[model samples]
Target: MTTPPFPAPTTAELAVVSAQLGRTARGVVGIAARCECGNPTVVATTPRLPDGTPFPTFYYLTHPAATAAMSTLEATQVMPELSALLAEDDGVAAAYLAAHEAYLADRAQFGEVSEIDGISAGGMPSRVKCLHALAGHALAAGPGVNPIGDAALERSTWSPEKCRCDDPGAALRDVEASTA
Candidate 1:
C-alpha cells in the first residue's frame, strides 16, 4: 500500500517548537539545527557502555517550509484550516489529540533510552533514523485518524550495539559550541 504523507508544522510553529527544544537541549548533550526548510534538527550522540558498545540517535521537527513542501500546500492556508477543523469538529479534534499523544509517547521513549544508556554519533541509529521513524509514523497515522497503532514503532528504537561514541556529552558540547 502507498503510504500517505505527514502533516507539517508552519514556519512560525516550527520556530516556536525549535526554540523550546533549544532551551531544553541547552546544557545537555544535544545540538539543534535549523534547516532551510524551517525544520529543527536535533542530534544526540551516545556514550559507550562498559562493554564498549554504542547507541546514537537523531531527531527532526517539521518546519513550516518542509511541511508545506511535503504537502504541496501553503502553510498559511493549511495551519488556519487545521485549526478551524479542530474547532469545528469534535472527531477531528480527537484525532489530532490522539496523534499528539502518540508523538509524545514515542519521543519520551526515545529520550528515556538515550538518557539511560546514551547514544553514539559515529554509527547506526543516527539522527536520520529517528527523524525518519517519526515522520513515517506521523504519515502513517495521517490526519483525523484516531488511536494510532504502534506497529513499526520499535524500528526507530536505538540500541548500544548500533553506536560508536566514547562520550556523548563531549560530542554534544562540541556540536553546540560550534553551532553557537
Candidate 2:
C-alpha cells in the first residue's frame, strides 16, 4: 500500500504558504511536503474547492524556490526531451502510468470529482507538460514515485536535500562584506 500523501496543514504553515504564494491559499487540504527549513514545499489541495471550482491539481507546489527552479527548467525546453524518453522507454512509460494511478488514488481520498476523474496533472501516463506539477508530485510522493519528476529535479538547479531558504539576509550581508 502507498503511504498517505496529505498531512493536515497547520495555521502557521498555512500563513507561510499564503505568504509564499503572495495571496490567500484556497482549498488547501494538507502539506504534502516540507523544505529542510520546515516551510511547506508542496501542498495537497482539495479536488473541489469551496468556490465550487473543480481544481484537478491536488499536489500543488508552494515553495517559491522550488517553483522558481521548475520554471527555470521549463524555460530550458526540457519537456520535449523528457517526452521523447517516455515514448522510447517502456519502463519509463510504465512508471509514468503508475504515477498517474498513484495521483488519482491520492486525490480520491478527498472524494470523487467527475471533472478530474482520470486526469492527473503534468500530462501523466502519456507526456510531460508542466515541470512544476511533476516536481511537486515527486516531492510529495518521495523518491521512486514520479520518474519524470525525479529526472526533472535531478537536472534542475534545486535539490530538496539543501535548504536555500535559510538566512537570505545573512547571505546578502556576506556578499556586501566581500564587495566592501
- C-alpha lDDT score of every prediction, in listed order: 0.34, 0.86
Give one digit per residue, the lDDT tens place, for model 1 in 1-180: 222122333334333444544443211123233332322333322233234443323233323333323233222243344345456777655654655554434334334453534332111121112223233334334323322212122222322223322333343344455556
Give me the displacement of residue 69 in model 1, in angstroms: 1.4
Model 1 weakest 10-residue run by lDDT? 120-129
Tell me the lDDT of model 1 at 109. Answer: 37
Per residue, candidate 2 scores C-alpha lDDT tens digits across 74-180 of 89999999999999999999999999999999988887899888998999989899999999999999999999999999998988778877663343344445556
For all predicted structures, in order, the TM-scores are 0.31, 0.89
Flag clash pairs in model 2: none
> Candidate 1: how large is its RMSD?
16.2
Top TM-score prediction, candidate number: 2
- What stretches of model 1 exceed 4 Å from their correct place? 1-72, 112-137, 140-180
TM-score of decoy 1: 0.31
lDDT of 2: 0.86
